[model samples]
Target: MGFLYQLGINLAALLLPVSRFFSPKMKLFVDGRKQSFAVLENQIDKNQEYIWFHVASLGEYEQGLPVMEEIKAQYPEYKLLLTFFSPSGFEIRKNNKIADITIYLPLDTKQNVKRFLDIVQPKMVFFIKYEFWPNYLYELKNRNIPTYLISGIFRKNQLFFKWYGGFYRKALQSFDHFFVQNDASAQLLKSIDFNNSTVNGDTRFDRVAQIVERAQPLDFIADFKNNTTTIVIGSSWVDDEAIYLPYLNNSENVKLIIAPHNIKEEEITRLISKIDKKTVRFTNYKTEELKNADVFIIDTIGILTQIYAYADIGYVGGAFKTGLHNILEPATYGTPVVIGPKYSKFQEAKDLVALGSCLVVHNTEELSITFNRLITDADYRNELGIKNLEFVLKNKNATKVIMDFIERNI
Candidate 1:
């Protein structure tokens, strides 16, 4: 199995150039990695000790942020090297201020793994969430460097639990500890006979809770809100728009801030054409026009979290279309959230829905009814928002749990 896995890695490396022509994302996946080792060679300072964090994408980056910040605070002497396996995370946050250096993770072949570990020589390594590259884990273990899985989650049906999963299970042995999100994940690790695990909650809650405490005010958003009820639709796709756009177009005396997931010119233009109400986009809009418009379309990136602070209701997109985006961003601000029906895969969405703090709608009719109730009944909306806020507050100490463990051992 290990031999086959190595073969698979080599095969992928060979095919990456051939796959680049398939899509722009694929091109990024191929081109960005070409510079990975060189970036490490140039940026890594052998004189300074380093701590490494690896995240799959932007969501995992967020999951890793609280711990990263804590580690930097407690150990200021160590430089941080953050690596991403996906372009979505690296492309957007490559210039982030947290990491001393950020680059793409070299592919998980033996040669690439050796070069990466050789260049970085990280004092501590953390794989956020479920990234378990077999070659990388094995090599890190061989070097005797401490590796941990932060906010780890596991399910019974995974390959690691199957009968012919000895190779995969061997990869799990590399981790010094497993800071999992729930009891089920802890139990699954135990089933595999890897007992170095703890049932700490997800670190994402701590990330959002910190954002709420340190949230900065946005004047333009306040101007557009115009002292009226505002619905912030975040990361919406076309299908998600289909569920709520009609209600937004027909509704009156309310403000809608819709930030589509894809902000390409065509996507933004098509969304603007569908709305019959007065609309002002973020890139080029006057405060006067923004104050007068019914809908505010954010065609740019970043600042979504600060905008959520002003929302009475938040419609997070992706459940009906591509995948579910973050609902916790808005929920952290005490905003009642609504999303499409396909949210079962998202644990936070499930928890919020079960608590009656988040609403799930199937179609335009259901979305309309949900919006009307939320708009007309301020007290009920406030109650739901409070519940969501309370839920976030309750789950916030996960970072402390993780940091405490690291302090005792690291």
Candidate 2:
């Protein structure tokens, strides 16, 4: 199995260039080494022990960030090297201020892995969530490096439970500890006889809870909302827009802030065209003009979190599809959340729904009805909002728990 895995890795390396033209993400993979080199060169003078954190995508990055921040704060002597496996995570976070080094994880081939370890020599490594690259884990174990899987989750039907998954199970065993997100995940690991595990709640709650404490005032957003109920549509996609556009048109005295997932010119144009009312793009909104507009489209990146400060309610997108985006960003603002039906895969969404902090709609009718009721019933909205905020606040210290273990173990 190990030999075949190595062969597959070599094949992927050889074909990476060929795949680059066809996939935007493949280009990032091919360029990862160069990006890593630049980060390493910039950090040559840094005099702190390095800790590497690898995340599969933006969601995993969020899951890992609270713990990473804690490690940096508690052990100022530790330098952080954050790596991403996906472009969606890397592109947004490449210029992030928190990490000493942020780069794409070099492809997980043996040669690339050896070069990465040679260059970074991270004292401790963390694979956030379920990123269990067999070669990387095996190599780290061989070198006696401490590797941990943080905020991980496992379901009953995952590959590890299959009869042919011994190799994958062996890779899981390489982690010195597994910090799972829930009791069910811990139970799953225990059922498999995996001993080094703990149920440390999702660190994303820790991250979002911190956002609430440090909420920065957005003057433009405040002025735009201007004492009216505002519905912040975060990370919307075409699937969500198809259902939300009609309802947004009919609503009144309510401000809409649409931050589409992809802000490409074509998509932005389509979004603007769909809305019947006076619309202002976020980039072009003047202070005076923004106050008058009923709707605003956020065409830029990086303001989604701050925008939540001005939101009275939140409609988080991506739930209309198979994969859902983060709902906690808006929920942290003490705003009731509305999402589509396809939210079963997202544990937070399920939890929020169970707590009455979020509502899931199937079609435009349910969305319209829910939106109308949530807006009209101020007391009900306020109650859900308060519950949402309390939920976030309650889970704020998962990072501290995980770090306590890391300090003791590492």
The lDDT of each candidate is 0.91, 0.85
* Model 2 C-alpha lDDT per residue in residues 188-246, reported as the tens digit of each score: 88877897888877899888877777877888888888899999999999999989999
Best by TM-score: 1
Error of 1 at 196 (Å): 1.6
- What TM-score fits each model? 0.97, 0.95
Task: Single out the weakest 10-residue window by summed lDDT for candidate 2.
Answer: 39-48
Task: Tell me the tens digit of each residue's lDDT in model 1 across 1-410.
Answer: 77888888999999999999999998999999999888888888889999999999999999999999999999999999999999989998999999999999989999989888988888999999899999999999999999999988888888899998899999988999999988888999898798999887788999888888898899999999989999999999989888888898789878999999899999999999999999999999987897889999999988888899999999999999857999999999899999998886667888999999999999999998999899999999999999999999888888898889889988
The true-versus-predicted C-alpha distance at residue 97 of model 1, in Å, is 0.8
